[model samples]
Target: MLAVELNGDAVRAKNGSMVAYDGRMGFKRLTGGGEGLRGMVTRRVTGEHMTVMEVKGQGTCYFADRASNINLVRLGGEKLYVEASNLLCTEEGLRTGTTFTGLRGAAEGNGLFTTTVHGTGWAALMSDGPAVILRVAPGLPLTVDPGAYVAHTGELKQQFVSGVTWRTAIGEGSGEGVQLRFEGSGTVYVQPSERTTLGGQL
Candidate 1:
């Protein structure tokens, strides 16, 4: 569960994520994740659908989804790339949109686009287990499993790597053949457990 304190300020959260609240609060569903008609149309076309609600009041509001563990991230003019299902909440001042991720998204079974959040604020990300933050530097690149990816911050380049060979195509190779390779400078949030992704067993 995530607790957010609001003092005349507002926040955008996943719809129906409010489990409890204290003091006076109002919840209004935001169409197309509050990006307006253009965003709605973009989401529909890209298949990155997100239903969000605005929570405004002077109290502490609690949010949770499927009892998943929450990770708090503070962004200072940086961008966060995450899957729509893993994002829980964000400050109202932040901007949210969808961006194409190409093969990486296809391998994760999350379609060809992913959600992007930017600006200086706080955002809550959900994962099956406690999230692990890994850093990617200039010389030190990071490779990750698509099923374990949660979100990432900073400037980084993501590449789809295939380890599948003739042996894997047959039956002698390891199940873990595809991977997401990250290079540059950024931090990646990964879950301890893997989700059921298209490349999980490939």
Candidate 2:
């Protein structure tokens, strides 16, 4: 569970993610991520839809999604890339949008567009289990399974890699075959458990 202390402030959270709240709080559903018509149209066209609600009060508000482990990310003018299903909440001041993700999205079976959060605020991410934070520096690249990738901060490049071989075609492929390679400087959050991806079974 994630708790947000609000002193008459507001927060944007996933719709129906509120578990409990104290003080006088109000919940309102925002259309198009609070961007109004433009956002609604974009989401409708891209197939990357998000249902968000705004919570405002003077006490504390609780949020949870599927009781999954939550990870907090603090962004300072940097973009955070995360899957739409993994995002739980964001500070009201933060901005959310969708971007083209190429083959990585197809490999995950999560569509070709992923969600991005920017600005300085708190963003909550969810995973099947506790997430591991890995630091990638110059020359120290990181490779992650598509199903295991949660979210990442800072500057990074992602590439799709495959381990398909004759054996793989004959049902003897390595268990850890396809992976998402990340290079550059940043922090990556990976969950211990991996969701079943289309390529993961191969």
Candidate 3:
């Protein structure tokens, strides 16, 4: 997993269980909280204990368990925006900016990251399993299966290549069918899993 901070230092959860610190003062939780959309809707639809927990800070924090190979880079003081497809569920509203899309089956305003963090900016991501950080030197340019590619910088343009198109047309998803080519020097994290899961933050 790659964890880069925009400003202050980010501490990992002591046990490192797909966790992150809200960078807040300690507050006792009276009860456990359910996360993601299910939890939020429950607040409105059922009027149950909708509120999960509270943090006493103004910065964004994140975490990813397992999928260890990582490449975290600071992008000034700005938050790196991502697609919900790229977003695993986050603490409450961290999945904002993930606009609605037809491919994923959501309509509108249905994700995380409602607000932006000011001083401290960072991107934390995980790999499906042990990953290989390939170096695209002069001769040996790295070409990986698209699924293996996780979060690369927005600067990288996506190129769709053919050779396995038939599989995806029928929804078979040829394991190595399509690949997003990164043509620059920015860091790209790749996990070992063929499924190449970016943990849905549920």
Candidate 4:
């Protein structure tokens, strides 16, 4: 099978559902249950319904039929999130967390979540994926703001560390150093260009 990609960034997702998506999204249609279906589905029957662009070379796809929007959040290093807003389905191998728990004072921005991959596996996010991917190696350092990351893979751990606040203070706000931190070795895929959700700004 090829890497999953959605023509548009959105499809529908249900409770207990999961799928990899790409590009921006439009309206998502639902089935018998709605948001209240989580108890019944347990994130199983949901994933993004792809548009035309993302499925150009792909076929035999998976889809989630309940979720509305999902975004790819970028944290520094190997950290990223399949943002709840833009998230369709995540694999059972990875871990997810709220972006606020780590730092209350700083790193307090909207449109960000925290996720980490434990082992080497594949996870898909909504985007046309940059034509090229950034390969992370020892001595090669990369830092992405919370709102800039898409998805990452390989052996890695995500920690909310002391960067969000310090970085925020640099501008003229309170000092709270809480950022989604990734420490380990891996690769991160980010689209130099991204699509903002409803507000149109990340």
The digit string of per-residue lDDT tens for model 2 on 1-202 reads: 9999999889999999999988889999999877678878888887888998999989999999888999999988899999988999999879998889998888888888888999999999999999999999989999999899998888899987898778888999997778999999999999999899987987
Clashes per candidate (backbone, < 3 Å):
0, 0, 12, 35
Q: By lDDT, highest first, what's the ranking?
A: 1, 2, 4, 3
lDDT of 1 by residue, 27-79 (tens): 99999999999999999999899999999999999999999999999999999
Off by over 4 Å in 2: none
- Candidate No. with top lDDT: 1
Model 3, clash count? Answer: 12
lDDT, each prediction: 0.95, 0.90, 0.38, 0.38
RMSD per model, one decimal: 0.7, 1.0, 9.5, 10.6
Global CA lDDT of candidate 4, please? 0.38
Runs with alpha carbons beyond 4 Å of true place in candidate 1:
none
lDDT of candidate 2 at residue 193, scale 0 to 100? 94
**Model 4, 137-182: lDDT tens per residue?**
6655555433445566545455544433444546743322333455
Highest TM-score: which candidate? 1
lDDT of 3 by residue, 86-150 (tens): 33323322322222222111211223222111123333444556546554443334566645655
